[model samples]
Target: MATVHNNSLNRLSAGGLLISLGIIFGDIGTSPLYVFKAIFNQGTVTPDLVIGAISCVFWTLTLQTTIKYVLITLNADNKGEGGILSLYSLVRRRAKWLIIPAIVGASTLLADGMITPAITISSAVEGLAIHNPAFPTVPVVVLIISLLFVIQRFGTSIVGRVFGPLMLVWFSTIGILGFAYIDKAPEVIKALNPYYAIHTIVHYPNALFIIGAIFLCTTGAEALYSDMGHCGKSNIRVSWIFVKLCLILNYFGQGAWLITHQGNVLGENNPFYAIMPDWFLFYGIIIATVAAIIASQAMISGSYTLISEAVRLNIWPKVTIRYPSDQKGQLYVPSINLILFIGCMLIIFVFRKSSNMEAAYGLAINLTFLSTTILVIYFMLRKRIHKLWIVLFALIYFTVEITFLVGNGVKIGHGGWLTLLLALTIFIVMYAWYTARKIKNRHVKFDDIKKYYPIISELSEDETVPTFASQLVYLTSANNKEEIETKVIYSILNKKPKRADVYWIVHVDVMDTPHARDYTVNQLIPGKLIRIDFKLGFREEQKISLLLRKVIEDMVSKGEIDITSQYKTLKKYHIPGDFNFVVLEKVFTKTSELNWPERIVMELYKILKNFSLSEEKGFGLDSSFVTLERVPLNIPNTGNLQLRRVK
Candidate 1:
């Protein structure tokens, strides 16, 4: 059994709590940096507009961020995992059509990954220009980004330790600042009223701008769902309440400051930092920079986890993964990290400032939010959660979300196309890779059962065969008759007669969602040989071994196999039998007939296939009873060496 850390209930230590705060809260925590400022600076500073914008921000947080995520979506956790994929897993079987929305949601999230770091760090670095007008913001931003990427090789554990205390201080500072300004302009607090928001939007001439402005307040809410597994549902829930309280206080404080210094606040350049006294400006800069980096860290780490889940589900190409800490689910993918870093740097260089990047930002975030809303509706339907409730919630949320999407849609000419374009590109690549792999696997058939049944039965009767013969298991293609004939031929040629009471043809189906439990079975073939297949639901985090044992027990009880007698010598009953398995692998050499993209995708699949689970564990066979026999099968195709047809 894996070591279970005491990260639950009272067992959680101070260190763990702090790390969770920093790593998980960074994205949402930093929203205060530009969210309110973004809304206010849209060329409308009138009392009605300010009141309306703040009101919209308030309701967006209360209803969309707090109510939807903290209350509803968080409850939808899959054994403590969250994200669009996790949500999809919970209802995919019952609502498979939901995959379309899930895919769109995931695609938009990928777009967010590329742009968030750029906007965040650029916004923070822009603060430097406030202290010294001569300081070069672009170069400084690039330097910070470069340093961030350099440290990714070491992983997040060391850095995570500092996140909690720093954010605690940051929030405290914002709250204190807000209190200072609230004493002077207390009426700003009244913006919390929903009526003020509705009134401002209705009475204001060009009220539609509030749609884009409200979208800013809920920017990182998806992170709440995506990182749900890293920190358990309870940790996030508890942490969020505190986080939200702090955020609201700070926003009110900013509004109060703006009210007190009506015409004297700094120009559009640095409104967030402008409210601080001169004595505190340096300190604020340091904190803002650190907070920005931390926010980017959350997105970076979340992106790695998302890609890992995608690879496991066969929606992404396989990349190497490394876990820096022994902590469960703490993983690092180097390839993804580098890609994100380079993309972010390019975005910063190309966009040059946060103002330009902001136009590109909302499109990705809004699309992702809209997609999640759609998926949540499907989830409600699958669970038979009342249709009236689903429709009512969906209509309200969808109308609000789509309104923001349209505002973002208006940004298409102004850098919004960048995010949409990136999303589409990734969607195409992922869709193509998935389609090609499925097509290739479908065409390649495994051997017939009759061809191998007699041999397996003969092997079962051989008493001379050792009780435990090998240490790995291999599976034959379930569709290749020629491969089966060759395997029989090779067994006779080698004089070993391929030994194992059970030889499995294993097929792993990576569904779109995380699984609640692993699936295993018996009698895929029957008495002579047991064909075991493992099905992993997308949300399940447990390794294959535990699930395999459960399957064995179920099979034994059903009289599918006699484990009781097989383990008579052992004190406790356990399945006992020496089993050897062979896997048939094919190496495809592309011919002229195949398309270039198909060939490229196939080659990538081959590389990914190398990283897949070994047949022994994949089929649920005990290590003592498994043996891997690799046999290669080749097929003829067109001479272009790009296209191949299976006959």
Candidate 2:
């Protein structure tokens, strides 16, 4: 049976649609604030420029956001869980090289997280400059960003409640605002023609740069697919219809306003604010600011989710994750939050303006979109979609994305290199963590548990050895029921010779499905040895200490095992026996020989291990009852022994 993963708002309902609007659409929804302004800044505002830009925005949303993500990619969910990693998990068996795109997509998306807040919040706050030209927006932006990160520890459930309603208002206001201006330049509707989009690029000056600016409108498209798990596919798909309409209206409305001011340079005057009525400008600014905050929140929360998933997938090092609320899937990672906060602060100080930050924004996300495109094509291939359909889908998106990439390539010299640099740094960490594990696994040796059963049985009854615990448990990596790690046997019979009344070998398998929590128990020896295998989803918390207790309780209820202490004095009282856990930690040894890449990976892995959570902590085991054993990880040197003994 498939495991059922439930979110309160995961079902299709009015509430779900509202939540989808709030959570999934924040990044793309708020693009109207700066997209037109960025486009207008590129060249003179004319009939061709305004209409062409709006047309490009419309098709990008339709092709990239609406068709690609909402209609198609949302269907590729892994047991209703969606993200680059989750998608990778679904089709990963199809190809090994798929890991490259998954890592690249995730890293770039995370890089986008840092710039999204910096750019969106700065754009909203910069509206203050309209009223007071000398107002310093940096400190205000910094304060908002800082407080946003600060409150992340307390959870966002309370604040999250207002997101849907607030975003609804944001979308409605922008749509209405856009509709009001469309009458000023009815011909702006001509932007719907593909000809205008083609002509603008072919005839317009700096056309490639315009396409780069236009790419910003669909930046939040990936979030729709990533967050499909939070809100079901139905909710996201339905909410997107309404969202796309409002976004189109707002973009067209801005075009209308800009067309009316043709031939005049829009000198630092934002067309977004310019279209608003004098009476509603302040209110509009306030609404935009709140929407910007909502967008930032979505990105921040998404970053946390991404890092947590990455950790579980073994691509990222283990870090401390705390659940501050009773809500499912709501977690806070302080290390990630601190890193994002620092990245945002650095962008604000360095760029100092949303315009400059915009130059850095779309480039990283373009790479992310291209990576998603690559994954989706493979996803289609896996589904065995018709060859013609798959080829057409691949050709269209690859061409569009590569074009966007080249257009955004212009940003490399301006400010785009910053986000690319951030993404590259993140990729290195994931690559090193993942590659080191593969290398480590190559050296690990397993022993047949059947061969040691008699020896362990003898050790349990041996009066010469002192008792280690009433019940001793070891977490094992061996997947087969009849096998255990050679080191595990070494630890028991060779290292210190631990004796116990009962021995338990526990193994946890992280599955691709998001919420699996089933386990199977086997009695390797009656009343002497037990093996329990837990099949948990990647997103499931690994609280082995608590989960083991629950498993023991269930076993006790079923009369599967004896819990009474084996000691003579305690046997009379019928008290429960003590349980101790042994966690083997591998330490890198200098004697191990590796190729250059392996050595580099192991060296970085060593540094990362020092900073990461301990094995016991990572497994969610209690420290007091857990024994940490350091095991050397040594690969045999291919060369002959250098030291020779004198006979």
Q: lDDT of candidate 1?
A: 0.67
lDDT of 2 by residue, 321-439 (tens): 99888777788999999989988988888899998887777999898898888888988998999999889999999999998999999988888888899999999999999999988
| Top-scoring candidate (TM-score) | 2
lDDT of 1 by residue, 356-453 (tens): 78766778878788888887887778778998998998988988888788777767887788788878876765665566656556555444556655
Error of 2 at 315 (Å): 0.7
lDDT of each: 0.67, 0.89
Off by over 4 Å in 1: 1-20, 42-44, 202-210, 260-267, 444-451, 456-472, 476-532, 535-647
**Superposing all C-alpha atoms, what RMSD in Å does each candidate have to the true structure?**
7.0, 2.4
Which candidate has the top score in lDDT? Answer: 2
Give the TM-score comparing model 2 with the true structure, all chains together. 0.97
Cα distance off (Å), candidate 1, residue 130: 0.8
